[model samples]
Target: MKTNRYLPLVGGLLLSLGSQAQTKLATGSQKPMPAAEWIDADTGHKIVRLTALDGANESFYFHNNPFVKSLGAAGDKMVYYHSSPAGKQLYALNLKTHQSEALTRPFARVHGEIVGKKRREVFYQVGDTVYATHIDSKKTRRVFVFPADFKADITTLNADESQLGGAWGSDAEKEIYRQYPAKSDFFNRIYEAKLPRTLFMVSADGNGQLTKLFTDNAWLNHVQFSPTDPRCLMFCHEGPWEKVDRIWTLDTKTKAVKLVHKRTMDREIAGHEWFGADGKTIWFDHQKPRGQTFAVTGANLQTGQEKSYAHTRDEWSVHYTSSADQKTFAGDGGYPTSVAKSAEGHWIYLFTPEGDHFRSEKLANLKTHDYKLEPNVHFSPDGKWLIFRANFEGQAQVYAVEIAKAAI
Candidate 1:
């Protein structure tokens, strides 16, 4: 692994101080809210708005769990999926009015399979049928169907869904869809239907038959299609007997697979690592057994090379976002970090530790290359805003940061 220079900045500076104030309680007693929301700078609108509906309740009730999913900008509007005691729903938050209306059909919840592309079209599941809905025309059509016995469980579906490829083909032509088993226990045996352990492809129209791209029975923990080449994919392969895990590359057309990285028995790759925007590199966390220290490695897929950004025993996590052009990258490398890249690829929103509150930073240097932060930070679909839920300022409340200089 290649080592880079270490330029340390001062520990704390309150970079976002006074730009925004914490929301106070109804009694003016300053009871900090348990969750917060933010808007993306590039889209010039709030992509997320959430709050604590169930006060201090942590029992496993689905309604009490507050989380955001399927946040993106489609056409002239911002869209997202949310769940509550009422049920699962999809909404289009009008950028002009700041109003949200349920787009999900009544009695037919928006299954976790929903995904939005660059156009106004959204792919989602209702019952056993996968449907695509156009936000502009309010038209919906069936895109695919599962086997008769297959059931739709939104929660499990959320866990199993993978964005294997980009929206490449036109609506009339070929489109790539990635499917995974909703249940982890299903990994023990191959489905009689010839489905793969994790990575499988089918026609967007659901006409062509399902094809298993990778034969390895090992569970494919994560799979990503190369943004540059839609026919190429990168995925992580693991099994019970293996001492370590490695990432591999596969060409769908040639039906060829190659081991891009070999595993060392003493260390394991972290599951949540992601590919760089360039599609030629992958970023992952490497953990050392019996040691508290961890390091982040960026591996070049073509050259079989790696570079380490940071190594520490501080229990830190890294969040990364790269420009659309793949020329610039911005991320926060630390514990409990949050980062969002602008869609135009010019700026990044970074939040770091500051006692009870998170100090926010809008950075323009895409070549800084090495840093670390805490995990679970999210970016808006337009890549202009960063949003997260945290217990800062005595309680969790939503906050937004503007990346004014990020338009590429």
Candidate 2:
């Protein structure tokens, strides 16, 4: 069947211009693997479980690059996490065939899903040691290990795949984590403590050369390298979203730091910042004053020109993502207990930017999904579907909801 590419746009416009209801999943809806795919009852769209793995499968964090998108004739592969009885490991799913290739064995505390698409490899950390594995060959190599004074998690890989960027938590921040362990226990306390944190990068050539970029007396985190500019890096001041000036850019060559978005209103905030596909824009989940309103806002990295697309409270998502071409956007909606305290926000949304606001069309109903494990959303490499991880099927597994309305 030929899909109408323009059909979804039409559906989005009608819903945005007229009336719409909060889409909800069927009671105890279960579209587990082996079934492969199912039609979302509320939205009439095809939703597919990416891989039929038997363990708890999960996708990458919202901003981290997971897909080795431009693989030419070989097609793209998405690297994700899996934990079974054998061991917790990393696997690359063949988007074309739905087959998975194991990339790593069981390792302790593997951090970040930083894919060096250029090198055709995935980079991660086991404590202070950084490792890179070949996507196609399953061959692994030691990238580099951070020194004692600069040990930190690997966050981003530079455009040319030369440098891996990250932030080192301060002793106070580490102590808070050590004592509290869980994010819920330490998140607030560390932020309020205003502990010192350092931003750094290490060479992928395995020389173990640590480049300590800079330090600040605030929680520095979410470090990302510009996808287009190897010398340019982006990070955030990790704290309570409402209280922090979150988005920032750093010039690796010059050691210059600039604040990306300055809050205009009293309680205005911008966080969860990520670089556009071209690396020319920095986009984030924006709100005028805390949980009152929501929008996905973007600021031109060079010109500082801002563009925002607003949505209703219930349309708000824990994380939002832009397609590879930057032409479309999608979000994995929030739950009732989310900070927005949404009454009905259980839909996986497909958003079309209609000037100042988004023309949103519900793609999948996620009413039964757990909110604790955030459904970090990403657009498929071909922009045909929105990929996200959900626990709605009783375990954390990655799924994709077709952007166009369809039945499988």
Candidate 3:
């Protein structure tokens, strides 16, 4: 192995992290690890395991958007799923105080940690009922519930927070899901089924005026509204990426459907899309030929232009997220058995956009992590740490790898 010249400097910053966490709560599980930090042996990057204990602790999914930073005197706050003694419950962490407080009673099914940065609340669905729970006050408000006829789920909140976007599958698609409930079993089947999917919007306040925006015989998955433009809603033709032109945007005002990324050559594909902080560009995992060449590509929604920064095959990540400044990026790498079949890819990566390619640095080693639980990475609001969840420590726990080699 080639030695890093910074290893000496990296070694100086090491804080011994045992094979497992040491602190345990009175309830017989590891205590909430708010300040638990360590240097990864393989990469020499500091890794802080956010959650400790047995059950899976999770952060929000990659495309669910911001981890909600309310920069007040109390400091910035981020919400997550914690395996509390009460079972699965919502919890919020105060980064400044390094304190965590459980936010919700265990909900059977909470949709997404769709944090409202301005409102300081998280919007999630419990079954067909939607709720918004305040992070600071712990006050929960029952929002609108889905209508009986609408059999759809809320996907994204619009820029002005006026509307919530969703996709409704035709009965054919629902039946297909019933037959092959497992995604792997029906992923391709539902795509090939080409069942009609409808894109619609409802008042976020639940005033109940639902408007059907667009309908097509395509798998309209990954529905997201622009963070800066409420009028622009993006959705994908979810399927085997190579076989379909995945990225698309629809203007809710004009009902215009625009294909965001077009394949330049046979088998070129794009998916796992997300919007920039300003919502001007759409960034996604891009490959020129399926599992071959890899890059995180972006498209200018206003200019109809695209740019890509290439990376090695082994560096291909299941998901990539940009920093608050859009100056840096992070990736959650695939395991050896993944589609990339990467030999040395089990590490969380920090990527700097350099010319046509990326300058890659390994942040945390995940060689022992179970690939079944994807460590969806998100950059800190201040862009100092990359937060993700992993199961390498025997159970899934949220972790953050310091981007800087040494404490700044």
Candidate 4:
């Protein structure tokens, strides 16, 4: 292992603040509203909005992840990153009490993940190092550190919270963009160079032991773990939606790697892939002929069976996620790629995997913008709430809708 000489300089900085616990309650006039009377057209479940914050603070849910691992029901709290005048800080919102508390001191662009089903420990990265803090005790420990010149992208914690995985590299694509900056052909230029990127796993118990599971000369991104299967995890070769072979999975026990929904032809774009609630299947949004649209697609990791659950004749329903039971699927009609057309309107839809799939109903009318990131709708572990981010009140804010307070 290569030693970072600067680690000693920051050792004191980490030790000084490691044991300190800081917290503040959610303030201001904005408060979460009760369930709206609007009945979901398919399930007939009442929709309830769960958050209303006044300022620009927002949650960090990604488009490709189906579950908000950070927002699991420990203490009924949801963790999010807030950009204050001081810096970016992590905050936990207690759903029952409707209070937001500070979890860490303000730093540069801080985001977090919650681990363990019952214990609920949190993980987040600052610079090239990852840290863990228990939700109840607030005990902090340094989990892992990356080598010099390499940055961590898309940090993920495994199902049982035994390991943490991330994509690390020189971030050459971002640096190259500064040199050859172009609006349309920027990614095309970056792909011309085989940038060094690696998939790394480390002990989640703050052992600081790092293992490089896979390395590539391409842009590897979105490292995600299976929710049920302990040994299974997935990643992507990220670039223009159409250019790369999108999804790949790795088994930690066997060190086996396989492509989930492999593209056999050109213009077959498959990106924004995630695992289902069962952890047996991987789900993704795919578009053939590149610029057309996307449909809901999935591949069973155990059986290797692939199927399409939903597709569009007119426009694409780009991002796809599912309920915890895997019985329900949700999608937003907005595609974030430059090649795909601008979204027609801000709408999210829901569908059943088994019957009446065509009867996908509009769940919410989102306030969205062009050329900006779209809200990735995710379900809670219990499948009762749909969590998403939107710019409804001018700035992006995290919001959740209770789909079924009790099972219908």
TM-score-superior candidate, 3 or 4:
3
Q: Write candidate 2's Cα lDDT for 127-208 as tens digits.
A: 7788988889878888887667765788888988889888888766778889999888989999889877888889987887
lDDT of each: 0.40, 0.79, 0.77, 0.61
lDDT of 3 by residue, 85-135 (tens): 556777776555545676776577465667776677788788888788888
- How much lDDT does candidate 3 score? 0.77
Q: Which digits, one per residue and each the tens of the lDDT, describe model 4 over residues 158-261?
A: 87778888777666677887887874566676666778888878888767677778888987877888877778879898887667887999888777888887
Any residue pairs clashing in model 3, and if so which? Answer: none
Q: What's the TM-score of every candidate structure? A: 0.57, 0.90, 0.88, 0.78
Model 1, span 186-244: residue lDDT tens: 34332222233435554454463444555544445445556456666666654321343
Model 3 regions more than 4 Å off: 1-35, 84-87
Worst 10 residues of 2 by lDDT: 1-10
By lDDT, highest first, what's the ranking? 2, 3, 4, 1
**Could you tell me which residue pairs clash in candidate 2?**
none
Q: Of models 2 and 4, which has the larger lDDT?
A: 2
Superposed by TM-score, candidate 2 places the C-alpha of residue 172 at a distance from the truth, in angstroms, of 2.4
Top candidate by lDDT: 2
